[model samples]
Target: MSGSFYKVECPDCENEQVVFGKASTEVACAVCGTTLARPTGGNADIEGDVLETVEAR
Candidate 1:
């Protein structure tokens, strides 16, 4: 699957961040340093509140 961006809100600190859908590495919240997403080969395993799916232009 193609990579995409997603808007996610940290459950711990409620900080919002943009993350890669198929991230090859772990993604963390910038504000609180909370673990947000983990790489899972295809789509990343998200651990935050998914605000929306970002559309590529």
Candidate 2:
């Protein structure tokens, strides 16, 4: 079983970035440096709007 990916939209900058579903560390927006996701030892806590969920291929 593998984790998935997500396309998250930054609320402040509206920058779209690919984030790991089970990210071990904090994920920030590339353009605005805003916190996008936080690690919880499982699926990350997505802060911004989750545009899509990308399955592992």
Candidate 3:
């Protein structure tokens, strides 16, 4: 697999973040402070069914 940093859209705050080499327990929206699903593998393994957006603005 390609080991590189990539941006992931926060399903809560809609903030784009580079998740690829940062250890974290929980991820909150960088813009709206909405708590996101627990990031798998620091933050690298982002972009997937990790979040759910019901209604957005």
Best by lDDT: 2
Put down candidate 2 lDDT per residue, 1-57, tens digits, no spaces: 588998999999999999988899999898989999999998899999989987773
Q: Give the whole-model CA lDDT for all candidates, comma-separated.
A: 0.89, 0.91, 0.50
Instruction: Give the number of the best model, judged by TM-score.
Output: 2
lDDT by residue (1-57, candidate 1, tens digit) is 567789999999999899988889999899988999999877889999889988653
Count of backbone clashes, every candidate in sequence: 0, 0, 1
Query: What TM-score would every model get versus the actual structure?
Result: 0.88, 0.89, 0.41
Q: Model 1 clash pairs?
A: none
If ranked by lDDT, best first, what sequence of candidates would result? 2, 1, 3
Q: List the residue pairs that clash in candidate 2.
A: none
- TM-score of candidate 1 against the unseen true structure: 0.88
